[model samples]
Target: MEGAPQGTGYVVNLDEKLGRIDEHWKPRVVAQMNDYQFKLVKICGDFVWHSHADTDETFFVIDGEVRIDLRGGPVVIRAGELFVVPKGVEHKPYAEHEASIMLIEPCGVLNTGDARNERTAQNDMWL
Candidate 1:
């Protein structure tokens, strides 16, 4: 099925389509545009502490639990919960167990925030 001219494409059997992603610490782009994109990431362990100086990033917990360490405090988000980190706020995300998360942000958002370590993935790998 085709997508609407001004909307995201119609998703048919998302669970079936997403069954291909099984690795940890890898993200897959589900949709994109000139300035923004939607990504699904499988996370476990501690990510780097960093900040996005130009754009806010939104994270929605799809499964399991995730803990976001902010500059002054920490927020634990479970499945169905969402959080937004405004631009320039130093934060680190971690999950003791495997967690699936969806991120909404401007295109070119560095997965590793500002750290730019080897964990930073460059390709816009689509699922």
Candidate 2:
């Protein structure tokens, strides 16, 4: 990972970091602050419905568009927009085409949240 040297916070180019990812739904850690981590991922199609019990999940759309389905309704997030899924609220994200996004959440939070299944990704993987 090419990052800024110690004592000097460097810049992380979102487009550049996102280009390295090829698989959908696999989040790669790009940066971290305290106990929170920033992850980049490419997503397509529908995701499993799940919720984080202890923490909220933030999604920043970088490219394309995404639809987050909630019990109450659905929210559409386009490029350069962001959305936060409240803690314990079930949400499923979907995209008609491939989309690049960043997820900000506490360290060790599972991608599948409480719905662990074949879609669960390994945690703390750095880019």
Candidate 3:
């Protein structure tokens, strides 16, 4: 198996990686565990409504807060907290200001699910 750097197989500084990003809604792959990928992204304003039909998505807040608008209601995820949006559940994510967050999901999952558009980012993008 391929090992990582720093003699620990992996050592990703989330703060450092987050500082390198300036775009919104674009997730940068930071690490991989088995078949899953851990991505860091900066979010603000409103995101497109979408859902992962095949797999659930875990949204973990690193800084600031995130609000996910679901058909039933809205789910607020604060810093140091996490929320999982189940597969096939239509939802839209929103953040008042720039929010640093991490998304844990299987590799190759699209940022925008069924609502593909210009906001859809290419899979497997690393920082």
Candidate 1 accuracy as TM-score = 0.86
Q: What is the TM-score of each candidate against the true structure?
A: 0.86, 0.93, 0.92
Model 3 misplaced stretches (Cα beyond 4 Å) = 1-8
Candidate with the larger TM-score of 1 and 3: 3
List the global CA lDDT of all models.
0.80, 0.92, 0.90
Model 2: which ten-residue window has the lowest total lDDT? Answer: 1-10
Clashes of 2: 0
- TM-score computed on alpha carbons, candidate 2: 0.93
lDDT of 2 by residue, 59-95 (tens): 9999999999999999999999999999999999999
Reference-based lDDT, residue 7, model 3: 19
**Which rank order by TM-score, best down to worst?**
2, 3, 1
Instruction: Pull out the clashing pairs in model 2.
Output: none
lDDT of 2: 0.92
lDDT of 3 by residue, 1-127 (tens): 1233311266799999899889999888888888898989999999999999999999999999899999999999999999999999999999998899999999889999888799998777788
Segments in model 1 whose C-alpha atoms lie over 4 Å from true places: 1-8, 12-14
Sorted by lDDT (best first), the order is: 2, 3, 1
Score residue 86 of candidate 2 by CA lDDT.
98
lDDT against true structure, model 3: 0.90
